[model samples]
Target: MSDDPNRIKALGGGSLLIAWQLKDKNVLIVGGGEVASQRVESILTADAHITVLAPASGLHPRTKLFIELRGDRVTHRDRQFEGPSELDGMDMILTALDDNELSNAIVKMSRERRIPVNAADIPDLCDFYFGAQIRDGPLQIMISTNGNGPRMASIIKKRLQAGLSGLEGQAITKVGLLRNKLKQRAPGVGGLLGRERMKWMSQLCNQWEMEDFSSLDDSAMENVLDKGWERGKRVPKPSELGISRRSTTSKSFSTTSLLLPSIAFFTGAVTATLLLSYSGRR
Candidate 1:
């Protein structure tokens, strides 16, 4: 390998970007300001149980509404933070207080207690920084600058959005459904049939290209699963199945594709079901 100064060396002393699995986990937010509310939205999507610990007078209007509406997932303390006892048994901590001294105190106490903490707008004291994300159905492209440049990450996210396929999410949805059907169709011993299913799906995605996924009609899907596996034969393409290629720039799922439920949710600055729309040129 050529020695390049710009090469990725190590994660030493720098942040490692990760998708934290927070479902059903408990998280504590030390402040109820706007930034704290923003934190709630991000963590809320992870299906985590969140408690905003700040007096009622300090809560941002939007934050209050989220706590009120999403009561199933959120709750408020309605009082100012006290001390170390408040930080007990927390899986994670987020500080959005304007009080620097209090922020420092919480960060120090959290470090002592070994809980991961994120101090908003104070990168130096944070253990994690939220990154920008581009969501399309089951697909996500996460962008980050290791807590150094959030704005830059947003810029990259927008660029990716512009170039993404509008029907890509639909394609992914169809492909995922086909995978489930394939699993039910083939059930051998432990690793035996699983390998075959994975190999075929890989080949399908690799050979057909992304947009071609949307061209797979019901008949084509059946032919691929049935005849293709009959003689240990290869899966047929949409063209071979007598289907015409779809426009890469098309923004909607082809009428020929399976009917998918349109499910999504969006709120201020938080995208729960951001199956974003995009289309590429043919």
Candidate 2:
């Protein structure tokens, strides 16, 4: 958490970043305005069972669309949220009402019930902030200034998006497939502990070019992975691979490291072009 006043005001101080698994959990949402609608979009991706309590008259268009699209996954209660009783059996609660008093009341009730609550635009009242994110298939990068600078986070996300290429996503998928296969082939293995496994995977990534993997057909890809697995099995210890135990435990490869140099060059080009244009205007 950042101590910057703006970030603290946006996200609150002492907030820990975490990914919640909301699949099939009941989430209670109070209000049906645009803010609530935005919350709905965020949670819906997690497959949470949602109940929105808001008057039937003033539902935001996006909220209405969510109800329509989600159908049985979402239930709409055509009434105002009265009190804490609504928090019963909910895994999480979100309040997006225009009334600060009502939002504060709900937050207090949620506290008493021990349910996590997020009050839209009220960092002090929220348990967590919806930080900016960039998704590349199964790989996701989340940026937060502890709620201080969301606009800055968004700008960074765009820069990263421009810098990264789709090849990295394919590489992640390939790596995941290889890991699963290795785990299945050598279950409860001694040599392939966390650190050793990471070392082997890192070496595999270093040895195999992304272009080579991309050019391969499904069968060829499997052959390449199988050959890598065989080589990994032969190196029973990290020492055999010339990687000391300390080195293996100290460092880990990041998937983002797979981004091609060409992609980075392009990103730099784009940034330079923008700077040059601004300088000309000045």
The C-alpha lDDT values of all candidates are 0.80, 0.75
- Model 2's lDDT to the true fold? 0.75
The digit string of per-residue lDDT tens for model 1 on 1-282 reads 647655646426656767899989999998998988889988888889998999999889989988989999998998988899998778999999999899999999999999999888888899888888876776767897776687898888888887776668878987987787777788665596788888888887888757777767676677777766554847776676666766654334453243342222225224522424222221
Q: Number of backbone collisions per candidate, in order?
A: 3, 3
Off by over 4 Å in 1: 1-14, 188-190, 214-223, 231-233, 241-246, 250-282
Cα lDDT tens digits, model 2, 1-282, are: 678898767863445778899999999999998988888887887789999999979899999999998887899999988767888899999999898999999999988888999988899888888888876666767788777788998998888776665555665776677676656665665663755666776776676544333333455444544555566533233223333222111122333455566689999999999999999999
Per-residue error for 79 in candidate 2, Å, reads 1.5
Off by over 4 Å in 2: 1-14, 189-198, 206-218, 231-282
Best by lDDT, which number?
Answer: 1
Please give the TM-score that candidate 2 achieves against the real structure. 0.71
